[model samples]
Target: MFGAVPALLTYYWCMKMPETARYMALVARNAKQAASDVSKVMQVEIEAEEEKVDKIGTASSNSFGLFTREFAQRHGLHLLGTSVCWFLLDIAYINNLFQKDIFSAIGWLPKAETMNAIHEVYRVAMSQTIIALCGTIPRYWFTVVFIDYIDKFTIQLMGFFFMTVFMFALAIPYDHWLSNSAGFLIMYSLTFFFANFGPNATTFVVPAEIFPEKLRLNCHSISAASGKLVAIVGALGFPYAAQNKDPSKTDADYPPGNGVRNSLFLLGGINCLGIFFTFLVPECKGKSLEEITGEKEEADANDMQQASSTQTFPV
Candidate 1:
């Protein structure tokens, strides 16, 4: 309820903000409108490009639709990189988010039927809150501080690698950890910590940085949608797999281990696979958007005039 209230307020605030100047200029091709909106906010006079003129740095022929061969030849791998990483990361992420197996594993979580319904909900929320405060929140801050210095690629790779290692450690000795509640909790928290500190944050940040301004928003939208789609898969898949009986177990009470251990092994393998896809992603730190994407219209605009380069007169 506390979280929902702020989101509602923020939605209201966002609704009141004006359309961005970038969309008006690039997507709508309404330079006048974009300039007007920008100038009003900036309190400055500015010239608007005529609708038919080519953008200053880019030739008209340089542009291509996203689905065109030119785009595929140039950026298809980049798109694939973002989509694959987002998908793999979210599968692991959403499983952890939706499963809450850590609580059950630690043996501290009371079954829902054993507790008052409200108390059960409170216990779940409070347990998750502790994980968030001690593990999730700190990791996010760590990402924010080091994303530029250490770079998103390195962070995400390290995060995925560590997460894989930890999950395997937890899953392979599942029975052992179940008996050791304190160690189980520590191990569980490290996964969350690495997740936030790694690809979970980088995936969101890099998509917004590495595309041309004209197409950046669309690319990011596609990447994020891929993540959500994978989340749906995780939601449906993890629970089903967790409940499956292991074929190797004969005891009815201990039917073959529902495939939880196998799923962890799978998740770890997916993380390992994600590393290959991640290599397709460019290292975007310290580079301007144009430099990253190789579309220099905005950056080159200041240097070009009509048909000739403007020569600066030395003062």
Candidate 2:
């Protein structure tokens, strides 16, 4: 598990690595420094783009360091709220997948010799494959659109609320021949659907918005690590909880579907808690990435003005 986690963390670190000279010039407030960082990382010399520097270097204002400012107090609260929401979302989302038996949950599968058990396992494995095919891959599109057009906080909250409704549907028993089948599809669809549009996307976006430049990368990494911590704890414990039937009990006591159902209920409660927490984040969409970083535009303007003045005069 530790090995797998570092592999995952490596992917995120790469994604968040310093990339653009544009971000660097604005964040570092020094064309020379920005060009140096870019050249080092990109493995090529970059001429200082003098016209592009914002002068104040406030573009990089996003950092975990901002929490100390009076102005940052409100955003700090939002970050804290979003962090909790992210933690719960990770727990529930992963627990649902674990319940599906993709992780080889301990003692859950029937003995290899039982044809019925083998058939059931194969059916579920195939069904889950089809579900991932239809539901998981296309989510990128919805995330791009919603993160751009919708209120991010509201979308995340709605995703959790709707998940609760799907859980309620699963908890109820219906008489129709296809009722359980329909319910499962609806529930799974909702799960993946929101994954694209809600907390899954928002959690990543929020840290980028709220922090100042110097601390942004480190804090975002920490936030991601925290979420993963929640997921790891659940992953380790859920299988044992789901499959361990009392040795003395009759065969009927531990039904095949019972563990999955219980796991869903556990996730449903976490989703509810997540919705309540979403209210804390500020609406940061439409703000320039620099402004979100907490850079002062006026300071940037003044610095540029002085630089221009310096250029006009004799040395």
TM-score for each candidate, following the candidate numbering: 0.79, 0.68
CA-lDDT, candidates in order:
0.75, 0.64
Q: Relative to the unseen true structure, what is the C-alpha lDDT of residue 281 in candidate 2, on a scale of 0 to 100?
A: 67
Question: Which candidate has the highest TM-score of all?
Answer: 1
lDDT of 1 at 87: 91
Mind giving the per-residue lDDT tens digits that candidate 2 earns over 1-315? 788998999999999886666555655556887788878988998888666564444333333254467435635666677678778878877755454442223233444345486686885676666656656666677787656788787778777887777665554432221234544665566676776567887888887766655666766776787799988897766654455244432133443334545666777788888888887766777787556645656557767888988886557
Question: What's the number of clashes in each of the models?
Answer: 3, 11
Clashing pairs in 1: 244-258, 246-256, 246-257
Residues 223-312 of candidate 1 have per-residue lDDT tens digits of 999999989877866765654364542222333445556777777888787777889998977776656776565346544664265565
Q: Please identify model 2 stretches exceeding 4 Å from their true place.
A: 1-18, 26-29, 33-55, 58-74, 101-113, 116-121, 174-179, 244-259, 297-315
